[model samples]
Target: MRNRLVFSAFSAAAVLAVVWPFLFGGQLAWRDMLVLDYPQMTASNFGGGDLFARNAPQDGFLSIIAVVMPATWVVKALMVASAVGAATGAWWLSNKELLPTLSAIALAVANPFVIERLLQGHWSVVIAAWLLPLIAAAALNGRALLVWLLVFVASLTPTGALVGITVALVCMNKHRLVTLGLGVLYLLPWAIPGIIATFRGGQDMNPLAAAQAFAPRAEEAVGTLGALLGLGGIWNADAVPDSRHLGFALFGLGVFACVLLGIRSVPKRLIVLALVGMGIAIFAWLAPAAMAWALEHIPGAGLFRDSQKLLILALPAYVAAI
Candidate 1:
């Protein structure tokens, strides 16, 4: 019960500290999260005729939910809920030790990654953050069915679904094949259709050229490595929170360095996935040509032009590693 209270307090504080504006000011649409303009369900909400269907599942879910409440309220409420849900997911993964729990929660909700994603209006990514930890706990605890269900729902976002699929592969010891099938099942609704449409239409893009445009950015005074370690290099200057520049990013670097001490606590497969995730983020900067080639050749690889989302795959490992 005490741990529950701690979790609840931190979850609420995490949301209120950064997202009070969304809560008090009501719905504010920015970037990809412009659901306020069309709050109600329509025939078009479920249809993304073009490839990528980037808004799949989330936008459609919003349409159904908005019918229950005003769109403004629904938008703000979901934002608040996703933020709180992130912290709660961290707490769920913790071992009930106060310090470790606090550290895990901070990594989960208050990190620069969550803030940057939120500012960029990528609430679905934030929802994925929440789902990642929940799925991790289920996988770690040997709850196969729960892991499959959570991973299936993570298909709401393509990037999140990618990370979620990785979670099933790296974290589970049993039902690996069956769990992996759930990953494919989730993709069936959106990914397959989008890929087919892209090929059928021959909508070609120069992935090599586009890679530079979507590469991870250097942060203010901290540089690209620091920003990526600090979880702040989000490719859009406007998306980074102001606090990141005010010494918080440097602090995050130090904390992330210290987080490596508990590396043995996490499963080895999870560690490999985390390293691969960070490596992928850096690859765009170090080997843009190779990254672009993969983007050009790999089906749906174009979606990762903003490769930082790949770090979502590492969230579970980071929390456990710490």
Candidate 2:
């Protein structure tokens, strides 16, 4: 109970730390502010139809949700409930370690830069963040059908694809066929339409080119020093995003400490996954040169253009490793 209280308090504090600044419509740093935008300008119509030119799934799942029950209070209640689902999922997956569990709770609460983005209107990302751990728990428990149902529901939203794919890969089940079939089932609705539209030249983008885009080259890779501090350091710092990178480092350190102390032995496979994921995050956050090299040599380096996605991969990597 004491631990739970600590968890709740930290979760609420971290969330408020990220969220309170914007509650009054006050300006956020560029990246936090950008969350207000991003997916809208992405390569696909998966964000939405070509309906408004703003036609992207920025709020895909949320829009459908609002339509079903348009009241603000109702939506907030439902979203909060979903956030609880996400927290529960994290708890189940974390091997019952106090610090790791606390970290996961903190991540879930402040995640995707807190529920602020959702409150501000980017419901798709919020939904995806909320679903991420839940789906991972289902996969870890070998509940293929449950995972499938989640994927299907999440697929109706925008960022869900990313979260679903991350969980699938990290869980790395031997029953790949089950996960694949379920994924295809969930995605087929959007996939079929997207493909048809492409063939008819009505699709939203050039998939080939879209797949090739890299991280914005000009954005400097900030290090962990400023991250240790609450604000971004002097050099071209993007505060929240930079601070998040710090959070990732702390997460990595926590795992390393666990491993070093022989708290328990971890399997080799999970260790490999965690190390690789952490390496990727470090490369992206500390070495601009390495990040560039990756962008050139690796196809999906750009997919995680926003280093924030590293947490998506990192959390499961840690959970599995633990």
Clashes of each: 0, 5
What is the C-alpha local distance difference test score of each model?
0.75, 0.48
Model 2 segments beyond 4 Å from truth?
1-63, 71-78, 95-100, 111-123, 156-159, 169-175, 189-308, 319-322
> Per-residue alpha-carbon lDDT of model 1 for 41-117, expressed as tens digits?
65445545544566766677677776676566766665566666567667777777888888887788767777788
Q: Write the per-residue lDDT of candidate 2 for residues 114-179, one digit (tens) a residue.
A: 332443344445556666667777776677776776665556442466557546655657667777
Worst 10 residues of 2 by lDDT: 226-235
Best by TM-score: 1
Best by lDDT: 1
**Which pairs clash (backbone N, Cα, C closer than 3 Å) in model 2?**
47-56, 47-57, 48-56, 48-57, 110-114
- lDDT for 45 in candidate 2 is 39
